[model samples]
Target: MENKDHILLFRVGKSELERIQQKKAEVGIRSMAAYLRKMALEGICIQLDLGDELTEIRALLGRCSSNLNQYARVANTSGNIYAEDIKDLQQLMTEIWDNQRALLKRLSDI
Candidate 1:
């Protein structure tokens, strides 16, 4: 017969601990030990660079809002709107939607 007797332990700082928890949550893993084991064995980690995409989306939304507000002001003051402005707004909205869709697809691929 064989007996199993072993223990493993380690210490991590508050920030390091928080980062571990965050990674677990991001990977949809519930067990901390299992997550660490898998990472240690397989050397697998996911690092997403979503900041640029988010920034671009935010800027696009800001532009859309500003353009809409300008259109509203013009319509209110003069009771008239131009076709070119409407077309430009539509183009901006399309770009925003397209970028959002791309981001979603990238996330799904992960």
Candidate 2:
């Protein structure tokens, strides 16, 4: 590690401090000093807003899991599975892949 011996002190208003803290949390950085240091040196931070994409992916996964459970129950009781049930699962999987690809594309653009 490089020597970080110098101390830089600064002051901001209440709202400014809150904004700084919010940005730090958004980027998943725990240390305020480290976050401020990086921002000061780099002068730019790229924060991706992926909440919607991730939420959609999570919903798709939940549906896929529920469908699998239902299929398993039906197969266990009747020893038969329908083609339509499999098709629905495949469609859910395809949607998940599409969302993942879009997310990846956005990340790559960043």
Candidate 3:
């Protein structure tokens, strides 16, 4: 994302400004511009840690994919596949899917 260099302004009554401050406090948002932008554009705004979690999940899946590729190479070179390695890979996949489902459910709640 680019830094927001543009400016936009509007006037509001004193009471309206106070109300906006109160809402920002209640929402625990520190950035007035960000809070206002979300309120104006989205109608409803929420703060969720899902972005961080999803990034972590993506990293984990990348590692899992790398490991799978490594195992495939080993199997091709050795003419063998280990049952235990397959089970471990399956378990890892299952856990990743379960986490994705949970995250989706949380998003659906919003």
Tell me the tens digit of each residue's lDDT in model 2 across 6-50. 999988999999999999999999999989988999866799899
What is the full ranking by lDDT, best candidate first?
Answer: 2, 1, 3
Cα lDDT of model 3 by residue, 4-104, tens digit: 88899999999999999999989998999889988888776588878866986797698789889989999999989999889878887887888888898
lDDT of 1 at 8: 68
Error of 3 at 60 (Å): 2.5
Worst 10 residues of 2 by lDDT: 39-48
Q: At residue 8, what lDDT does model 3 achieve?
A: 93
Residue 75 lDDT in candidate 1: 96
Residue 16, candidate 3: alpha-carbon lDDT: 98
Question: Top lDDT: which candidate number?
Answer: 2
- Candidate 3 total steric clashes: 0
- Per-residue alpha-carbon lDDT of model 1 for 48-109, expressed as tens digits? 99999999999999999999999999999999999999999999999999999999999999
> What ordering of candidates by TM-score runs from best to worst?
1, 2, 3
Candidate scoring better on lDDT of 1 and 3: 1
